[model samples]
Target: MALTSIKTSGDKIEIVNQLLLPHTTEFIEIDTIEQAHDAIKSMKIRGAPAIASLAALTVASHLSRALQADPAPEWLSSPQLLDPYITAQLDFLYTARPTAVNLGAATRRLKHTLRTGVEQGKDASAIAQDLIQEGREIDAEDVSRNKRMSKWGGEWLIEQVKAKGKSPESLNVMTVCNTGSLATSGYGTALGLITYLHETRKLSRAFFTQSTPYHQGSRLTALELLTLKIPATMLCDSMVGSLFQHNDIHAVVVGADRIARNGDTANKVGTYNAAVLASRHNIPFIVVAPVSTVDLDIADGTAIPIEQRPALEARLVRGAVYPFTLNAQGVKEQATVMVTPEDLEGVYNPSFDVTPAELISAIVTEKGVAVKADGASGFDLSSIV
Candidate 1:
């Protein structure tokens, strides 16, 4: 299905503003490196891969514009000047989201292109042209890989269900956080798997957690699923146990923020809680992310750096006014409300939590699915990486 994120107009590119989502559907034009960096840092545009793609595409757009200018830019006339200028821009965008490796990978790829072009003794304009095409490829590749991983994960789940003697057509799956269209350039990771099942007529229903603090599931995932016309139900972060007790859920799929070599996963903060519950119920727990999210440098979850969000975010809730006042465009106007008492203290808001490998049932990437070794508690992702 065509997603709202990848809207191409002849040669122009724009992305939906995720910060104002659900309540507002604003498509912001991304024409410069500064805009891409700001969108990522401000959470106006997010999802690790999606942000990376935007950053790369912005660089491509800038160069494409430069190439077509009547007199051509001065920077394009000198190889030495052009190299530093492009390197600085990519590095600046890299700082916007230091945690996600994909963003760094994208920047590094561009840097490599620049250095290689220079070493090859190419002229300034030739190097600029090479960098531009490479940048566009970086953005275009993500959606294709995402679609591949989604299909792989989806098919595996169906086969697993059938092995249990259950009809794959009636399989119900649960997921945590938002891994739908908004979470990527398109398709998504784990959510993309759910979408694939629905598209092929093998899914019974899709259940998602509210993914609290951020509420990515409630706000972003819900919107994406609804837009696709997929049959889905929303649950609060605390309700995973309740849902498991009553529903015949076949699997639990989640998007990963980072994965250690031993399969310990750092995903949205409440994910470990859900993984624990899923394990108790003997339900399969799947972690879906690009290979870039796997950090071989981090031997285990303890070594992974978990980001702590501001206390204010944990205290406030933003959404459309409950009664819903329509704007001039007939869309609801949203408001922010403090969910906690004034001056609430001791709020713990780590952006993600680590799920030990022992609890994870499988790990899926664009490359392929990695399952735990027989009788082993964790995975050795060295080959995959």
Candidate 2:
């Protein structure tokens, strides 16, 4: 619903390249499926939902161009030849990022289009047309869903504050990791909730954790909130407890990587730490994500597969040159600097950490808000999902 991440000019698609982000704003054109796969694999573009949207959009762009090519591809000439080709491409894109369930969902939607067209005995040309429309819809639907969830979560937070005999206006909220324009199709999830509060004149400030190792909070989330002119502050990953001690944070909001059937949430590695600290401080801990993030198959957090990033990634930092050094083109020179000792031993780098349902005060999706039963340690998410 928002034109933040995906920019389109006729048939072309370009995404803000995420690998060279924070210090530099470079938008790379993604005209082919291969480029989409490479961008996701190399981390040139990331954040589960965003990556999936790009993958789906890439296919749409490719098909759009193919339909308008100098000569239609032979596959488009016949129904039998085109089905397998499209199926293979969707499957390939699905593998780009394994941890984000959204990618899988996007691929599955595309596959459904393919199957329905075939089972209905549509010609190859008609099937291609349907797929191109479906692909773009996959990306388009994300933003609207994000907006709905943001409204649900944001309003719920305000009501919770008022019910507790506190002023609903001027609420201060803390969020972990990036859940903004750069992380989703648009508006964002948890960050969207924060933005909603700001827009409604009920927010005082938004405090975000640095979300160490990846620094999605410091680098990406900070840049996004600033762009939207939302009042916000950034704190290091280690300062969650300290922030709670001094700040009047109304709640701690976060985005989910995956949600198990029992309400266990898997999110950025530092999210569990924040949830633990929020519980200790008697603050409401909220999870905001699309219903697609709910994994009914997973019985609990233990069953959710956590992706472990390469050890080297935990020891390096990449940024533009500091101290006001300018490049030949008058731009800052960017470089990757290793932050760890020359020879370091074992590094524990998990892309996500599971937050038990007990620590979470509420789970907000587009459907509705789900809270744990009175004095319950876990939640039954079946009805909600």
Q: TM-score winner among the candidates?
A: 2
Worst 10 residues of 2 by lDDT: 1-10
Prediction 1 global C-alpha lDDT: 0.85
Q: In order, what lDDT does every prediction score?
A: 0.85, 0.86
Can you give the lDDT of residue 57 in candidate 1? 83
lDDT comparing candidate 2 with the true structure: 0.86
What stretches of model 2 exceed 4 Å from their correct place? 1-3, 382-384
Clash statistics: count for each candidate: 0, 0
- Residue-by-residue lDDT tens digits, candidate 2, 277-335: 99998999999988878888778889888888889999998777777578888878888
Considering only N, C-alpha and C atoms within 3 Å, which residue pairs clash in candidate 2? Answer: none
Please write out the lDDT profile of model 1 over residues 259-285, one tens digit for every residue. 888999988889999999999999999
